[model samples]
Target: MPDIIQLLPEYLANQIAAGEVVQRPASVVKELLENAVDAGATSVQLIVKEAGKQLVQVVDNGSGMSATDARMSLERHATSKIRSTEDLFRIRTLGFRGEALASIAAVAQVEIRTKQPGQDTGTLLLVEGSQVTSQTPTACPDGTSIAVKNLFFNVPARRNFLKSNAVEMRHILDEFQHLALANPHIAFSLYQNDLEVFNLPAAKLSQRIVALLGNTYKEQLAGCEEVTPFITVKGYIGKPESSKKSRGDQFFFVNNRFIRSAYLNHAVLSAYEGLLARDTHPFYVLFLELDPKAIDINVHPTKTEIKFEDEKTVYAVVRAAVRQALGLHSLTPSLDFEGDVNFAPIRPLRTSTGGNSFGSGGAALPAPARAVEFNPDALAASVAAAARGLSAAPKSARCPRGPPSRPAASWRPFIASWASPCARPKPKCRPSRQLPRCLSCLLHTRSRPKTRARSRWPPRPWQRPQPARHAGAGPLRAAGREVGPDAHRPGGRP
Candidate 1:
């Protein structure tokens, strides 16, 4: 057989890693922003064009890298965070994976200009397809400026897989939102085609949410805080009523690092069980702090999945803490409907004083019109039924006021007793047939064996059975007399 073994080039390996690390424009944004944070940047600016497929720039006034480190940063597995295998388990930084920059450089044209503080000159390096074309000393600021252009230039198939500009821009915004939430003390600026979308300064967590989403959520947030001997939880959860139609607003971070844990997410939703509608979800920005050894952060290339050692306990604690916070906020309050005693239900028409007025303003307006009467009984009973907490369904088509026939199966899903959709009055729910079958039917159909009621009828294996006492401790005796031989002799007299 011919020689079959061959070594893959460094550039090819980096390109393969790029497939996992840099999936799209947003992926690049996530990595560069993380690097900026790791550089100790308090303020970071992000700019993009054509949803970052054409241009992407990140500028941060962080602790910039030295000239040599700047050049070495493009190499795969080149990182300042990890040195030994033990260091991987005790990671305290976000960009330790080291594949982020290398993968990004592999797919796009990358340019880096960075200078550490007190350095006479800065380092400027340019690379395309993981091949360095230029490296020189240059005058620059005391931080890093990375610009990625023509993403996936060599790979046309990957470029074709990218989404539209608007869709991709939204993804970039979402990434920026999570990062901004995780670090409220850091200032962030986002610009698209020179039009500023977000220019947020250092502010409180609440301020960050309001600024990022909008002012509409200002009054609907509730704060949550809990500190235990093992872990600490602190952040905000949206009021049950303020939940959105989508799950786009929920966020969870562990030690300021964003994560996606369904197990932990269920803990959040479980807390809002009775308060929120079945279809609705509550919004939360929760932060969890624990010892590094208790969880594993290396489960995924994205560093979003973390394994916990006692997840059940953590789930319960987080749920309870969020529930307590909601309770104190009184986010879900009872409804109150009462007539305004001072005002009539209907009033007489009044004249306007503007250009379309009935008369000149110089003439005093006519005396206040008399109040019109309104009958409380004029409303339909169906309206009153809702007030009494009863579900007011369709009026059965007003079928001639006679005995009604069964409706079509189309309505069966809604009226089914087991369906939870009809259980609420405010939010309308459409029942789905795809719901899982219940175990109640199986349990009821199974036959059960009958057993004695005595508590000790079935003794444990380790315990001794009690002895039953008869007339004597020897063989069977009749009336406390041993008559075995005498009885046999009398019967055999012959």
Candidate 2:
């Protein structure tokens, strides 16, 4: 190539750089949110449309820049965080990469309005595709409100690469959750399609978690804290049982800045190896604190990837801290060694198939049966119609009665025998096996032949009573037990 590196057009250079800094909508959210934090924002708001394809706005009450600084922020390699080569190794801020703003502005239409606290007026900058269209004086709040619109508008290829709105929204939520969790003291709000998803006031990490996730997490959290001469780790890791099938809940932040480190993530998962099911993922919001010099945040354009000097030590410490916290949490389930251990009796649904799907505790489930070609809903309607026709007939055509009802005590013996020593209630008398005989007597005598119990009992597996299988076909079979009443004992804990 002729003079391949001699000179690259400014717009093309920015677009090329954007590839590393803005991979998706989540990337934009991460960059903007980090900028807000770097600005010393105590409160931040994120609003998005079509998951930032159409718009992404981050409003922050931080130290807003002057008109000159605001314009310079959109230029490549223009940053306030660092000025010299040595500053690269001693990075402390969330955004040291001067590429985020330029990369974002290169692919989208960006509008920045800023005003310092004491400034009487603010500056409004309108930029599109790395070119500033206007920069004028305006009246605005004492903070910054940056809006990015029409993302990848000039880059059709990049625009085509975006995922669906729902998928992108989930990614945005993930970034918001990470930042919000790391800086729990900051008030954060999020809106999507004009509906408020989160409105968290400045609060403790635990409270912030509940606010971000939902109230259901209130009981599932366990606190973790560890400190050494070189590093300190603190935050909450969800209980082993509370893990999900997906990886949404895990979070790692170094010195209050969100980061992505598969090495550290593995450390967390390793700590939970035995406690969690193989397919489930534990939730954690851990914050690691250490000197800036020990970690390099400039390796990645987005600054989410960092390299630690003594990675192995950090990994071990993180793992131990998480494991120790879980151990101290009484919520950790314990095996009842005092009682008999029955392995084949029941396979408690250890991992759900959706959302929260991660862990090392999954009992290999039998593969599902292939579905046969049939429509059962139509069959059900036909059966119900036949029953109605029969019921409308004369008394002489009525079907014969079936069985009689049994007294409650008749079933006591089976319940008493199966009851575990760990059962919650106070001491109670155990019934005898003769209870089934009592039921037999009641069924033979007291129960009416024609009338059936009007109970809301769920249909039995065999009684699911499917359409008659073809006479020449094999016996209809299922791969797994369609759990009957006996499968899940009443009031039993999983």
Q: lDDT tens string, model 2, 13-37?
A: 9999999889998999998998899
Clashing pairs in 1: none
> Could you give the C-alpha RMSD of every candidate to the true structure, in order shown?
30.2, 22.7
Residue 105 shift from truth in candidate 1, angstroms? 1.1
- TM agreement with the true structure for every prediction: 0.67, 0.66
lDDT against the true structure, each candidate: 0.79, 0.78
Clashes of 2: 25
